[model samples]
Target chain A: GAGVSQTPSNKVTEKGKYVELRCDPISGHTALYWYRQSLGQGPEFLIYFQGTGAADDSGLPNDRFFAVRPEGSVSTLKIQRTERGDSAVYLCASSASGTGGMSGGYTFGSGTRLTVV
Target chain B: DQQVKQNSPSLSVQEGRISILNCDYTNSMFDYFLWYKKYPAEGPTFLISISSIKDKNEDGRFTVFLNKSAKHLSLHIVPSQPGDSAVYFCAASALRGGSNYKLTFGKGTLLTVNP
Candidate 1:
């Protein structure tokens, strides 16, 4: 992909409904990151993936939120039993890693706006 | 607790003047800092960055200054232009080995440049 791509740019679901947001990172990028941005707040880190394994999951808000990067390429962020408070934009970013110096800066997707009513 | 903080919620600057956006962080472990610009409805775009080793970095009209001692940083836009008007966020991370690095961002400062 020319840039990081996220699906279902806008999603609306009733509270308690499960929703899944998808992200397709740039080709050959090895590091993928997920972030959640609420109204009037900066993007908060949720999880990060290095290859198929999650290197750090400390930022996940709670058990209700989870993400996976099975092939280390396309990833999905799943929210179970969503609440109205979960309404916000989910952002995904990718960067080339491995010598640890991909400082080219992260390429981010437009983001998915999820509204939990 | 917010590791990164942008005190000003909004800023209005006259076009062609200087616009200085400030940010502060409580985490001393954050050695890498970055500034991102976002337009309405668009994800943040990386503007400039400064590593722990350097006190300042410049990229065209964007410059990021890092003061490790104060745990503060600021983005300065000289001769600010209307096109430069947008929401600016400050992010910080340790950048440890890359994979362990996770960016912590501030609430962001909205800069409205008026002509």
Candidate 2:
């Protein structure tokens, strides 16, 4: 793919409903990330994946949010018992990065706007 | 414990003038910084970035300055245009497990260019 792609551009779910958001990063990108952006704020880090294992999950808001990148190419973000406060845009980004220095940039997806009512 | 902070929620600038958006971070351990521009209904696009070793980096109309000592970085857009009217976010990343891939972003600053 030319860029990152996120499924279900918009998701409207009721409180307590479980929803899954998917992200397809660049074909060969090994580093994938998930972020949540609330209104009037920047994208907040949620989780990052290096290959099949999650490198950092510290950013996940709580036990309700979980993400996985099975093959290191595509990822999914799952929300359990969605809350009204969970209404926000979920973003995905990938880069050809392995370490620090003048490296490549991250390409972000259009983002999935998840609205919990 | 917000690692990055963009104090201004919004900024209005006249077209053809310079627009400077500032950001400050609390972590001295962060080794890299980046700036991204985002429009409504679209994801943020990578604009410019600066390494902790460098004080400044520029690309066309976009210039990013990093002051490691102050834990501050700024993005300067020359001759601001309506096309540049979007929310800008500052992000930082640290090395972990032989890679620095995760990024912590600030609460963006919306830049509106008035003609």
Candidate 3:
């Protein structure tokens, strides 16, 4: 792909429901990241993957949130018992390498707007 | 703790004038700084970036200035245009051992270029 792609551009889910958001990173990109942005706030890091393994998951809010990149390309973010506080834009970004300097910068997707009501 | 801070929530600038957005960071380890512009309902787009080794970097009408002593960085847009009106975010990244390099972003400052 020419750029990073996210699925379900917009999602409206009821509170307590389970939802999954997907990301398809750029072709051959070795590093993938997930972030969440609230209104009036900048994007917050959620998790980062170096190849097929998650290099950093410290940013994940809680155990309710989990992400997986099984093949080192497409990734999925799963939320169990979504709450209203979870309503926000979920962004996915990819870089050619794990080192930010080597990749110039990460290419971001349009993001999935998740609305929990 | 907010490692990166953008004190101004909003800024209004006249078209064709200069627009300056400021950012401050608390971490001295941050070696790279980047600026991103975002519109409503869209993800942020990379604007410009500056490495700590350099004091300044310019691209077209945009220039980024960094002061390592104060851990401060600013983005200046010359001849601001209406299309430049958007939320701008300041991001910092540091190599924290191994290959872990995550970006820390500020709250963001909204710039409105009024025509």
* TM-score top scorer: 3
- DockQ in order: 0.53, 0.56, 0.58
lDDT of 1 at A16: 97
lDDT preference between candidates 1 and 3, better one: 3
Global lDDT of model 3: 0.91
Order of candidate numbers by TM-score, starting with the best? 3, 1, 2
Task: Point out the higher-scoring one by DockQ: 1 or 3.
Answer: 3
**What's the CA error at residue B43 for candidate 2, in Å?**
0.7
- Interface RMSD (Å) of candidate 2: 2.6
**Candidates 2 and 3, the one with greater DockQ:** 3
Task: Give the number of the best model, judged by DockQ.
Answer: 3
lDDT: worst 10-residue window of model 3 chain B: B94-103
Cα lDDT of model 2 by residue, A1-117, tens digit: 999999999999999999999999988888888888998777887887878899889889999999988777889999999999999999998877544212555788999999999
Q: What are the per-residue Cα lDDT tens digits for candidate 3 across B44-78?
A: 88888888889999999999999999999999999
Clashing pairs in 3: none
Interface RMSD of each: 2.8, 2.6, 2.1
For model 1 the local lDDT of residue B96 reads 65
- lDDT per residue as tens, model 2, B1-115: 7889999999999999999999999987788888889988999988888888899999999999998888999999998998999999898887532337677789999999999
2 or 3, greater by TM-score? 3
Give residue B109's error in model 2 in angstroms.
1.0
